[model samples]
Target: MISDSMAEVLRLLQLDDGFDAAAEVAVRAAETLGVDGLTVSLATGGEQAELVWCTDEAAGQFEDLQFTLGEGPGPDAVRAGAMVLVPDLAQVRAGRWPALTTESGALAVCAVFCFPMAIGAIRVGVLTVVRRTVGPLTDAQIGDAQVLAHALTGRALGATVLDQDKAPLLHAVVHQATGMVSVQLDLPLPQALLRLRAHAYSSGRPLLDISRDVVARRLRLDLNGNGDGNPLPVSDKD
Candidate 1:
């Protein structure tokens, strides 16, 4: 059953050639999966991110509560590079995100699923869905969600965010470069992103191009940041 839904995602990806069209498909897919609301956020830069697309006005409220209150499952999923599932938000309000969890549960959104949106090696955002019933996702649904998550990740890599210095969001070069640094420093993914960003700034290079160099292994990350970055000519197109 869910395989058919995943196939539908691929087919929808083929038909909808742009972000807006893709958003529509995502919302429809959620409906087919029995979710009430959905929000798809594409990572922006810095300590925070931006919400790119969302289904239903309720989803906007859900996102806003997190932004305004400064904590929630959505942000956690992005930062941790993992899915954040709230099978039932109603009773689990003593810790944090009180308003959000309570309101969502009150609205009969009992189960919430979040899937990380990742590029080849970088995590950028999460695909979030809210369900009226409180229960874990079945294996088929989880598999279908994974497929949609990948689709969303690919779309985010090509997205545009005015905040990222007016550059394309989740640039491929950055992801490649981050992977390269991750291996070199033996650091976690988020930490590696910081390293790549810092190196690019010190070298006075666009983060994307430099990241490409790092990912291609043409430019190696020096564990010691003291050395002056001598820009090396990287022939490979990453």
Candidate 2:
């Protein structure tokens, strides 16, 4: 099953155009982990998550809940660059995202785990797997998730590049833009990317959309931070 899952993951990558493969991978991964359901959220988008694929009917509520609210394990995982696992949503009561957690219970999500998707240093999105029971992931499962992350990252990378086009999310564009944004803002690459994210979210737009504008001279980083970790910028093409 693991091998099959891995193969399915590779096939998902081959898609390079649709969500069908991604949905298949989610289902296969769930089977491999013996979990209840799974969903893969691609960060190639903006503040709002774009579902690359989700397995089963149950994944719908979980995925839509996050998209509608703009908050959930997937969002937090991408923001914090860490995985969030709720072995049982009902058991968590304090300091958790009240709305997101509450919705988790409504979705009947027992256990949820997320992994960030990134190429080299550029983050693309997150992949989340959930079960209906409380328990810890075994070492083997962790390894499997890691492999899935790597494969998903590759898929995202391939999809964004338009045959030698230096896209902002493309690894080459990311590195180059990071250097330029860093020098322009006098911030590190990480902070520059954060600034980019900040600018996009503040405008209620997608990060990639903002990135393209920036890369194409249609936007400039203004650097007037709003303390929400969002950077200020002027859009040339509003």
Q: Which candidate is the best by TM-score?
A: 1
Error in Å for residue 155 of model 1? 1.8
Q: Write the per-residue lDDT of candidate 2 for residues 1-238, one digit (tens) a residue.
A: 2355666655655554656635555676778777787777776456776776778567667877876777767777778776776666667667566777766666666777777776445667787787767887776776678667756665555433222232445545445555667787787565677676567556877666766666676777866755346448574564
Clashing pairs in 2: 43-124, 43-125, 46-207
Give the Å error, residue 227, model 1: 24
lDDT string for model 1 (8-36, tens) is: 76677756667676677867777665678
Query: What residue pairs clash in candidate 1, if any at all?
Result: none
TM-score of each: 0.64, 0.61
User: Candidate 2, after superposition: displacement of residue 111 in Å?
Assistant: 0.8
Q: Which ten contiguous residues of candidate 1 have the minimum total lDDT? A: 227-236
lDDT of each model, Cα atoms only?
A: 0.66, 0.66
Candidate 2 residue spans exceeding 4 A from truth: 1-8, 11-18, 159-178, 181-238
